[model samples]
Target: MSIAIVDARGWQNTLDLKTGEKIDAAGPVIKLVKDVLQRHPYPGDTDPGSNRWVSDTAFDLIDRYAPRFVFLTYAAQYFSGRYTPMSKETRARMISDVFLEAERFINRSGFAAIAVGTGDMTPLLGFIDVTRLDGLAVCTHWSTRYAGLYGPSPDDMKILEEHPHIEKIVSQEEVVRLFDGTPEQTLRLPEYLMLAREGYAFKTISDAMRIPVMIPSLNFNVPLHAPGHTVEAITGIRQILEEDLSEKNVALIAIEGVGLDEFLWPHRPCRNSTEWYYYEPGEAQYLTIVSGRHRFLDYPTGSGYKYFNGAEGAARSYPFSGHFKSIPEGAFASTFPGKSIAVGNKSMFMHMVTGADLSVECFARNLYNQGTMAVIHRADKL
Candidate 1:
């Protein structure tokens, strides 16, 4: 079976089987993606067929071709709707209605929808019925928490407070409850979003709105934003990735490589697929993930420092390891880099981390057979 990409505008594009995860979205996934949009219908345009991507052709292709994978862009995400003239309530309901309709249609058509986006989707939690949904919608918030970095679009705090069933969602019992995660630099949002795109499943920001969210992993490109260009943002993003040791660097993005896989490139029929990468000129070659079989690179890329040196290029991603190590606090404190007394076959070293970001850990660690195992460092020490 073949695959296809659906843009946020609700248009379709033939999925390039060769590119793997960088799936191109053209045909209408966005309801207005290709509308050139005349609302009242110009002349005979009254017929739905007047529009191409969202017209009969797209749905017909969906029915006939019946692709094995349907990739939906986050054309409907928080940033996507900011420009719309709709009020917060109208916008929420409008986007909610669009997604619910898409969910029902995709379900009825018998295909899993890997809904993709770039920000805190938790706001929509109050407005969406996730139980009836299948597949996943991958995006990033601050660390595994649903705390939105920017404006927290549509502000679920206000929405849920007004919701009659808000109790089921909020942590506080007060009717004036409002949900807020952590607020840091807005510059980091793009990099974190890119991390979401990288499928790192890093630490997700949390809040009362924090729910176990994300869809599937499949290599696809949503062509959004990249924040590594600036020295501060790039340096900050890299700090969290390589080491979020200090509180100062912690807020940039979650360094925990927990749900890295399941958030982006899906792990299925692609089960046979190994080594996930997104490489380009002068940018860091994100090794992202190497799944399934027990495999390791013979030689290290040694490009660790490049990511922060302003190479403005891709760093050979190696600090990322599919292995998780937990160090017992007291004894493990002495077990610093390259001098640990852990049990292992060959004498070797790896970048180790604790499972501080629970939400991201839960989302990423179990993505595939390679799986994520936690080291009980703190608990063991305690």
Candidate 2:
């Protein structure tokens, strides 16, 4: 019933500053996020680094925003680009180091923190015991929804016809075997099952350790595409949370942020450039405060995975491109049948939902616009 928008700017960027910048004496490094939120980045994006002076007083600002919990995010700056490409062992070590550093900052700040793990964290998180933290999110592979690709192929997507794309990928028998180390799942094609094994191995190990793992999925991204869709998606999310809370020890919801080339931007290049379902700013508040963890809560925007909720029907997304475009008046056209187009292009829903994006900017719609309508509970208006 409590929450605070914690920025996980990764670990490295915490101290690294722009030239001529002085690190504001030691403290939680969320001042930049605070300034961007409190003071409009109006007149274009304000270099938050310039406001390093605010880190010293971040706690004061947090006190003013007073909510329930906080998200201890790892900043990306040099870390993401620099290390995201390293081997699992290397990335895991870096992630673990970041975890230790993050804990120190969170303790110093006096806030109950939830761990948001993405990027090179899957197998690595399994290496640590996360139950000691307020919460931990075992983020699955970013490209898993593509049936295991940043963009999956028809063959890869076949099995998911019966399950949510992510569920199908992570829950694969092969993946499950890898999690427990067995040869039973060899029945499935090696290519399809191999990539998933990594994530499933991580999730399985993390869960085995009884770490408070938050399950993230493209499913929760449903709420932001349209008002009507948002209503239904929110209802589904609440239902999932309420059920888990009632049936389980702690309930968590994983809704991703929807944004322009958001942080999880193509961890590795794929066959085609594609983005997936994530929660935008205002969107995460409802789910986070209400249920559990949604990746990139700080990012603003998302797509949905309705199959996870059940009863997925025909729906439309923003339709940016790649879902079969119009000829545009004499543009060279293909003979792909119109009848088959509707049914054949069903995949477009996923693209539009995630790849397209929220029609409005979250900065204008959520951060700047204040009212009773908010995903996470806002503090008393100063």
Candidate 3:
């Protein structure tokens, strides 16, 4: 299949110092998105503005193309204050604003079968029929990193359980069982998993902050199948995708950092993970939805794609393997017979996670104004 990939990373970034800081060129997708939203702000200004730009762009894409399946990942909440120096309260306010603005656009976007990252948005989106819980957060015992790998110390484990933020402590063995058992070396899953209580996320021994965080949860009614968990929801999303897409559209909006506490969409109580099961890198989490299988490829440090199968070059992407041999089978988009599009601001994620026909992601280079690019299949790298 010939899929069109559009990268919208630096759409608002237009400064070229060599050219006297002139505004950069805007791509067709950016132009279209800007036209619909009726506002354009440099994404670097604030966390809410960055996320809203991405979310609004996704809404506009769906409205314009009316594709069969739409997958969106919003990243500002996760990226904003975590790395940069910002007060915790300021970060929290920015996230709230992003969600609030997203709620307004999603309701008016006109798609009926919408799935979001949290149960918090479910009630507000009266038109939504299905929901999935994501961004679930858990407290980790960093000091026990090496010790827990072998087997957590009984005394240390007991101490971890006493923490006020901890709801339950899941051990390495228990975590292995959760993903149906993976070789510990392959994924290097966390050793001592400290599941956090609602309204709290573990930061440091001195600081367990009460903030919105996420951990992976059971894939109940979601479109993709997760290997170990039972689909408790009445209608599975896989069935819905294949059956309904013949006559309608489905939107899967993944709010990256906002979990149940932050995104709270009022979903029926479903199972959350005992601890994070994927590799430490954030991209691994997407595999649960895209491939619906275990972590077959192991990434060393940065991106899975960068090191996988010796795919080299600065771009860090490979061809569309179509689950034929290169990657895991049953990738959602690889199976789709119709047009599917994935759009997100997270670098290299849209193409890596969903094998959508047309994948659009924020340009990794410049977040300010450079603009989006399309990913096309070459004999070698993307």
Candidate 4:
């Protein structure tokens, strides 16, 4: 099996020295290709922007070098903000356009496998047809970040249990057992068991196990709390990804009871004040009230879905002070590629999942006052 890796550079940030400012750029993206080509040079000329040219180069490289695998990595900058500019739909469409261009190269080249480094490259996973690719992997230090959240607390194990989304929790010993197990036995365990059966679940067995289960399609009602109360919820999501769903390709969706403005305001105040004036919108603005809520929702699924909820687990929050919003009536099948869905609260959103093909919709209530939700879908379906 021959492999080829492609990496691009220069997409994440655009330099504007004239004003000493940086803006987002469209072309000449930066990625891992340079690093790989440095070690293993490709024959013939290289082309930029032409997906067909890139695809051909990948195949040519594989044919010439005959490597077991090839890795491709790239970066892109995404704009996030409140009102100063574009609407959410417009941003999403822009992203989708870039992704389609990249997919042409990825899907056409027949390689044994592809591995991607963490960065702005994750969203592309949702755009590609994984089934056509031999094997795929993403590299990130997500587990380490998750561990840090515990902050020298021994009760981390207990915290995992109360979390509705986390299905299993285990120690290092278990990891070894699963890795050493036979292929058949490992397959019977969690999806990660394909790598090792002894592996433990992070927050809940649902997070750990891929076994399909029956869950109601209707949405469930839950209460919202202060932002400080969100630690457990966020941590629970982290544990699920690091522990249970680490090896799977998944997407997340978060719904909020409060509008984008109130949910992300500093200090979790009901009303925006001058003290929280730092919440202004900008290209690099990292402090949007909505972004925070979105991060809490996407934290588990490795940022596959940013900002609003996708077709997968639609996590929504109902403010204790706000009324519940009705999801579009009628069941619509989730576009997620997997068999399970995880939710933050139950309500009309939950009902939507139940009515769809989703087998399970795990609900975690009061995890955060802001309504946020996530769903883990299979990659093949994408």
Candidate 5:
């Protein structure tokens, strides 16, 4: 079979077949996807309907094919409350409720191995067989006194170094050196990277409170944030797919905005470590996981990157030029020799990131009500 892409972002596009006719003619997998989309027909990313789309689509896919590798993104609840003004306690509980529901599904669903995010990768080994990889020690930072927005002044940088919440400050040059990344990766990177202490998160100098990254204790022999135990999104996930999923079904799900304290099922299998880079604007993180590289390697973030990057842009339904590179490769989807599929409510991500054999995501324009669309790769067509 070949790679198939399902885009369920907008209302039924101008197609020859009526919506009902299309669903009837489609294969069972595609039919089931449309059914789920219709059931939870809401149109916004933060809406309950969107979250239901994520959970329902995942459950249906698992029951039908039990695909060996499954990746899901459940962030609606996190998105709903992280930025809203509310009491810290009230806000924490709001997010926790959402995590609990998702965790409940994981506990009940019997997968051979599972890995949850917002922590280091090795901790997942406690639940399954896996290897650790290098994760940057990323912290959210904001100026305590200065009103700096973009780049901090040299004098302000000095004060930032001594800020109570600051752990260590870094520059784009330092980031490249630290990660062994190419200079291109540092483009548009914050002028001064102010890392937060283990228990802290920072907002922009002018913004209000920021959420700190939290990971479960997992009761590891060493502390959760212990040095050398941390894992980043890109390599950590690659290791899981390579080493953990050995001829058995595996699920790698990420519940955004839920930190350590908010993770409902800490007692369940998983590990704890810091998310090294910016976790919000999650499209970047998803790309990092699917590509096994930092997003910066491809210039122009998000779907825009698809236009210039040969590996990502190839096979997309939209028009693109493969100028920067030839014979495109790098995305795991491009190389994986298996019948894999990805389904999630995150728009434009399944194809952009995993490029799985069959990838499905919310339709960006209409999101809800409109049925999903599918993309079948010429090489791996079913």
Candidate 6:
């Protein structure tokens, strides 16, 4: 039927009143619930505040509405007191206890299903007994910071291993695939079969072949800095859509971060090479070039002269197919623009393209190592 999406922050007595006064400790919790519900209408004569008086109200709403699903959205750090002036451990336990109580209530009430909407609430996902919930979902943008917030970490894997209720953990690839289009197909027939099927006229025949349709390459420049280090490497990637590669598309991805231990902190100069690379749509071609601390790499098959690194130099480009044998640690990769690129111990090759064409073959060839052998095309015209 219908669903109730509860924001725990709204229920807390932390809002500024119309009179510019804070809700007092003696303020009734029901009043807070009523205030929130008043903003969101209720059906029939049902009182939104009444159901919230006790934690059971969460379940009561689900049961009464008989909604196809009930969603709970929360900020884990805020709920666990990381953002507030409270004991972190104590607040985490308190929030966990409240949710556990809510789960117990939901179990007693026969509702369709309960889903938790983690809006950048990754840390709390592990803290909760997700196994008891019917379903769970995470949503966030594709920036490095947001990706780190929502992406599964070691802690998440541990929780998945221990919890059975976590039916699925959606990935960025899957989400992107949900928005891609299907492939086109054609059939071939023998001359006799064609004649038997229909009145055939003589026509020129072409070889059975799959010609690669090259999409225009987009350039992404990212800056990297590390203090007191002799050499630092920065890398950046962005997902590109096939439709966005048209000649009319003028958008370009640019770098915005200076090298530093913490990306949000100030920048300092260090000896480093900043590189940009991306995959060609519908083809296996990895194009990469190094700019800083060295001359720009040469295009695969172009003739251009450029100088950098305090000397007359030339650029040399290479196909990244199988070239990225390893990805260094501290290197950051993202499908969205405006993310810093850092290189550490692990060898990595990351790319982000425009549009919604997120084929598994392209993703695995560019990011993860587990995939079929990818054919790398060297740019003959540069």
**Candidate 3: segments with Cα more than 4 A from true spot:** 1-47, 84-92, 116-240, 243-247, 269-281, 296-329, 365-371, 376-382
Q: How do all the candidates rank in terms of lDDT, highest first?
A: 5, 3, 2, 4, 1, 6
Question: Top TM-score: which candidate number?
Answer: 5
| Model 5 accuracy (lDDT, Cα) | 0.44
Stretches of candidate 1 above 4 Å error? 1-64, 83-86, 112-382
Q: Could you give the C-alpha RMSD of every candidate to the true structure, in order shown? A: 23.2, 20.3, 11.3, 23.7, 10.8, 29.0
lDDT per residue as tens, model 2, 141-227: 222222222234564355433432123343334433433333432221123321222233223112322232222232222322111
Q: Top lDDT: which candidate number?
A: 5
lDDT to native, each model: 0.22, 0.25, 0.44, 0.23, 0.44, 0.22
**Each model's number of backbone clashes?**
50, 32, 28, 50, 17, 27
After TM-score superposition, what is the CA distance of residue 121 in candidate 6 from its true location, in Å?
A: 7.8
Over 1-382, each residue of candidate 6 has an lDDT whose tens digit, in order, gives 0011122323422222112233333223333333433343221111222112222333333332232222221122222222234454754454454344434544564422212111111112221222222222111111111011122446655655464432333343332243231221001101010000011111111111221111111212122222222222222211211122221221121111111221221233222222222211111111221111121122111101111122523332222222211221121122222211110001112221111111001112112222111111111111
Error of 1 at 153 (Å): 34
Summing lDDT over every window of 10 consecutive residues in candidate 1, give the lowest-scoring window.
Answer: 339-348
Local accuracy of candidate 3 as per-residue lDDT tens digits, 1-382: 1223332443333232122233434455435434543333225412456766666666665666555777776666655533345565875776677657556656776543444452221111111100111212222221111112223456545555575545565555665566556474435444444544433334432213222223222222223222233343322434455555666666666665454455445443332222342232244345544554444233212211111222434432233221121233455776776656676766666665676655555554323544453332111111
lDDT of 1 at 344: 10
Question: Which has the better TM-score: candidate 3, or candidate 4?
Answer: 3
> TM-score for model 2?
0.29
> Candidate 6 — what's its lDDT?
0.22
Q: Stretches of candidate 5 above 4 Å error?
A: 1-10, 14-40, 63-66, 83-97, 103-109, 119-171, 183-234, 267-281, 291-296, 299-334, 364-382
Off by over 4 Å in 6: 1-57, 74-82, 112-382
